[model samples]
Target: MHREKALDAGLHPEKIRVEADPYVPIAAARREILEGIVTQLRARGRVPRVCRYALAVGGQEPRHSLDAAAAFAVRQSWRIGVGQSYTDHHGAAESLTRPGWCLVRQQIRAGYADGVVVVTHSVVSPHIDAYKQQLNWFGAHFGFVALVVPEMQEWRP
Candidate 1:
């Protein structure tokens, strides 16, 4: 359906990359994130015997399932030990105040995983200022990196 719509909209089929919607409960998004992280780590010659990772997803409600995310990580040969979801239920919380965000920070601090896999950069907050602050905080506080999966909007398809 998406392919046909893109074709009708004058996008070449070859150029239409059908990416999984990160905002949906799809395992593909998780897989892609894991793959990208692994690739990045490999390029940096930081291959650990086992890739242990934690997941942090942000939204008023979970856009993806933790079980599916874990399974996807396992399928990629990664061991996901922690998973958390953050929500602005009342729409009145800062990025740093989210329980899930705090859990992620704790996991990193405690050395539970090599790094975190965020569903998107917006997992911190939708506001640009908040996002920048969150990124800076992660960089300054944690020695390891936090990898964000590519959002669907990046693809023209």
Candidate 2:
């Protein structure tokens, strides 16, 4: 399925553009896609444009993955803007403390002309559910949040 269709399925915490690495989970595909994009752009000596869709969130491990992936991408080409996290004021007290969503929301507020490219882990931690809700809410409010999950040919219909 194409990127648009995969997103329309409404599978929360969807995985997109996964790599075949044994250590990597199928859920982390979006990060893989970002990494791949970074690698490709570097190879071509070109800078990637700002992707407003970028969202780095979820469990601590996932957040780490996002950091690593974005760092890799940024090192290659600094033109890209990566949104790291968001924090919802109305969310639970624990949710408010976590820095996951705050980083991402800051980037989103920074503005982008070419749209955003969100890179998040496949699974959502309990602490991240509120953040996740924010993502869904943002999508609902803006009407252009696209979910991209990368499935192997064996998994794809």
Best by lDDT: 1
Tens-digit lDDT string for candidate 2 (42-125): 588855554322223342234443454456436544454433323232222443344544444444455331113333322222
The candidate that wins on TM-score is: 1
* Reference-based lDDT, each prediction: 0.48, 0.38
lDDT of 1 by residue, 26-58 (tens): 234434544565677678876422222223334
Cα TM-score per model: 0.47, 0.30
> How high a TM-score does candidate 1 get?
0.47
Q: Check candidate 1 and list the clashing pairs.
A: none
Candidate 2 off by > 4 Å = 1-64, 71-79, 82-96, 112-132, 140-157
Model 1: how far residue 8 lies from native, Å: 38
RMSDs, each prediction?
9.9, 12.6
